[model samples]
Target: MGKPPLSGIRVVEFAGIGPGPFAGMMLADHGAEVIRIDRTRPGGLSLAIDAKDPLLRSRRSVSLDLKNPDAIAAVRRIVRDADAIIEGFRPGVMERLGLGPDVLLGDNPRLVYGRMTGWGQTGPRAHEPGHDINYVALSGVLHALGRAGEKPTPPINLAGDFGGGAMFLAFGMLAALLHAQRTGEGQVVDAAMTEGSSVLMSMMWGFRAMGRWRDERGTNLLDTAAHFYDTYETSDGKYVSLGAIEPQFYAEFRRVAGLDDAKWDRQMDQGGWPALKDELTALFRTRSRDEWVALFEGHDICFAPVLGFDEARADPHNVARGAFVEAGGVSQPAPAPRYSVSDTVVPQMAGARDDAGLLRELGFGDAEIAALGH
Candidate 1:
């Protein structure tokens, strides 16, 4: 394994679902030693269709019930030397489990305690059971998706779950870690998916304030208001994306599609979007997604194929950049945002280390190990 950027930073993950594991994965990607504290039971919820569960990448897992006295003591020992710890659970679940930050942070003042949840740490919906779609729904992002006059389609949990949820938690934890390293003081990060999802829509909020964004869902420029900034299907049932947002790009797009001058000049004026979209749709239908991909490969036309996970992994750009790495016969996204001179190893899948290894990595010694034996 190549040395990763987060090589020496040890992270403990109290696994929950969705964003929690994903945040852990991000830390692992950055080269942190992330050990997931998992229960023996896979529990009630599981979404393991992608074999290795892409979100579960870049971490080691350990199965233990913290209810046990020995296990609880073991965790305290781990936290005492740990840099950061993240958990996704209801407000009092961790405290009920006897591993709350109040107790843990006191054990080590330098620990960055990150807590992630659906609604937030404090709210009417804090105790409610909801998922990404629910958070997006409440945050108004879900309503902004899909075509005009249609039911609000969920954007596959990107806004709430990962974008708002995992990404935000990871960001907060890392930010706090940096501060802790410099000041030798630890703090708690309360990350709420609803808040994060709403933060992700700041640009849209700005557009709304400027009266450029419409609330009618998918009726605005970026949300299918413009004919050029949308997706079109091909003869082969595949699809390609279009983003000819600029005048020059739209002109080039029309030129490529054999559009005449009069129709081409009607960019973003009047109700010409429907006509333009219909024309482009008809033109795109003439070829498969691949054909158009080749047609617009190097153009500023802002074109791209709507490739699926497998196709995405196989695409030349993804392949060339090593976007997906294969491990344990499963393909998953590689660690992101490459650095010039950092260790770059894909964290081994699942529990690739023993308890002793995890303990020592967190600064446990033989005496501490013997203490756990009691």
Candidate 2:
């Protein structure tokens, strides 16, 4: 077995909720040796057992008292040999703790400092606290994600938190790491959820600029406005999604779904979309979700049944692709983007290593590690 892509790359993650931990998970998933600096206390977080939180997997944990100077010095020692550090806090939180990027990067010139926040390090709202929903709401994503006349639906926290904040933070950190390796100068990566979510809306922004997209939700081509690219409820109340956007795919859809060619001819006629969607809705309800799945199984109509979380885990395609794996007696998504040269292994739970053991690995002596406080 080969080493993971990020093997030998050490990361010190200041334990945080949501995107910060998620970013660390991604790096650890890709073979980075991530050490999470957990707080000595619960710190108001729910702090579930590490086994249940898959995001905290693939990394080791070291509980520390940030208020203690000894603990702070111990972390500085860890950062001295680390390639990067990740934290999610308000603008001046790390600075107040004497662990800001400037100080860390000063000590280690090649450290990639990744900062994750909802509003970024600077700006009017930088110091304010906000969650995933609030971030996406500011990014114009929340306004564009619902039915025509209905209230805008929050697409959970996927868009703003994970996709925008965590993914971008990891990406930026890696990129900065590369640059640091080449130039011997590290930099700070300010990955804001609002900025990340806004970047995700780039395509929609272009469409809006070109007058090809409407400002209202559920009225755009890709926003469930088009009959050919929406979900319909099955007779069993399960739903199936369609994306027969092109002419060829739409033709296949018409044939397989047993649609009348004459009536469904004008696929892109905006005025007729509502009626066409109503017809599709009525037609789809005639069969069960499984029946629809069978009809479109091998076809190129871009269709699939909307399976629940349990259903998704047991899905044949997902099973075939090894999309999910069981680790620490928990079933969750496996490491993604498989490598050809380097193999990605199912990550083990990180809490297995005790704090002293983790510190010893970082070259700290037993006595020095003990003096850091519990």
Candidate 1 global CA lDDT score: 0.82
Candidate 2: lDDT over CA atoms? 0.89
Which parts of model 2 are misplaced by more than 4 Å?
Answer: 42-49
Backbone clash pairs for candidate 1 read 3-343, 4-343, 6-31
lDDT (Cα, tens digit) per residue for candidate 1, span 1-374: 35777889989998778899889888888888887876543442222223367677767665565656777877887778789999999998888888898899989999999999999888888999999999988988888888987888888878898999999999999899999989999999999999999999999999999988878986889887688899999999999998998889988887777777696687878388887788878988999888888888777888889999899999998999998889877788877888887856664665343655656665768786555431
Q: Positional deviation of 147 in candidate 1, in angstroms? A: 0.6
lDDT of each: 0.82, 0.89
Error of 1 at 370 (Å): 10
Tens digits of lDDT, candidate 2, 1-374: 58889988999998898899999999999899888988775452323346778998888788888878988898898899999999998899999999988899889999999999999999999999899999999999999999999999999999999998999999999999999989999999999999999999999999999999999999999999999999999999999999999999999999887887687899889999999999898999999999999888899898989999889999999999999898878889999889888977577875554777878888989789878752
Which run of 10 residues does model 2 get worst, by summed lDDT? 41-50
**For model 1, where is the 10-residue window of minimal lDDT?**
42-51
